[model samples]
Target: MRVHLGSDHAGLDLKNHLVSWLTEHGYEPVDHGPFVFDALDDYPVFCLRAARGVATDRAAGLDSLGVVVGGSGNGEQMAANKVEGIRCALVWSEATAKLAREHNDAQVVSVGGRMHTLAEMTHFVELFLAEPFSGDERHLRRIGMLGDYERTHELPALPESAVGLGPDA
Candidate 1:
């Protein structure tokens, strides 16, 4: 698998560590990075490129995924999601990592450099890389709804059970 990585100054160390770890695990790691840390560096500049790398590789039928890192990972996740056809999830734990891949079919995962120890974040990345999407009917249907909305800008029709359940109700 090809794993694309990006990060700001706050996450430069972790991102660098992941590159080495990913290669050691037999995965190709592409670094879309600052290479040298600059305190004022922006996460979006690198995260978007990492996300696009995954999107492009997937479009070409290659097995690829991405990781974006920052102080809190929130901005990086948002930046990644701005790319068309990219599903980027902010993952904070083992369960979130697994669910990001299995349930959401996320191609990119965002990690908070300041939120956890290096070991913990590394474990989360490992779990994310190891999991596969479930492809269950319900999951697929929900993914389809989001994709439809992305392409058409049309809201999905409410389910029968949700039709009348609003704030006014």
Candidate 2:
């Protein structure tokens, strides 16, 4: 697997660490980086590139994924999500990491550098990379709805059970 990584100053340490770790684990790591820390650096600049790398690689039929990091990881996640065809998940725990891949089919993951220990964050990434999408009917249907909305800019119709269940109803 090829893992693309990006981060702001706050996440530089973890992002660098992941590069080495990914390589040791037999995965190729592509760093879309700040290279040197700058406190004013923007997450979007690097995160978008990493996300785009994953999108491009996958579109070309290669297996690839992305990891974006930041102080809270919120902005990085938001930035990566802006790329077309990229499903980036903000992961905080083992379950979220696994679910990001298994349920959401996320090709990118975002982690908060200030939120967890080095080992914990690394473990989450490890789990994310190892898990496979479930491909269950329900999961595929939900993913399809999201992809459809992304391409069409039209909201999906409310389900029969949800149509009349709002508070005003």
Measured against the true structure, the TM-scores of the candidates, in listed sequence, are: 0.97, 0.97
The sequence of per-residue lDDT tens digits that candidate 2 reaches over residues 1-169 is 9999999999999999999999999999999997998999999999999999999999999999999999989999999999999999999999999999999999999999999999999999999999999999999999999999999999888878887788634
| Model 1, span 52-80: residue lDDT tens | 99999999999999999999999999999
Q: In candidate 2, where is summed lDDT lowest over 10 consecutive residues?
A: 160-169
User: Per-model C-alpha lDDT, please?
Assistant: 0.95, 0.96
Worst 10 residues of 1 by lDDT: 160-169
Badly placed stretches (over 4 Å) of model 1 are 167-169
Model 2 pairs whose backbones collide: none
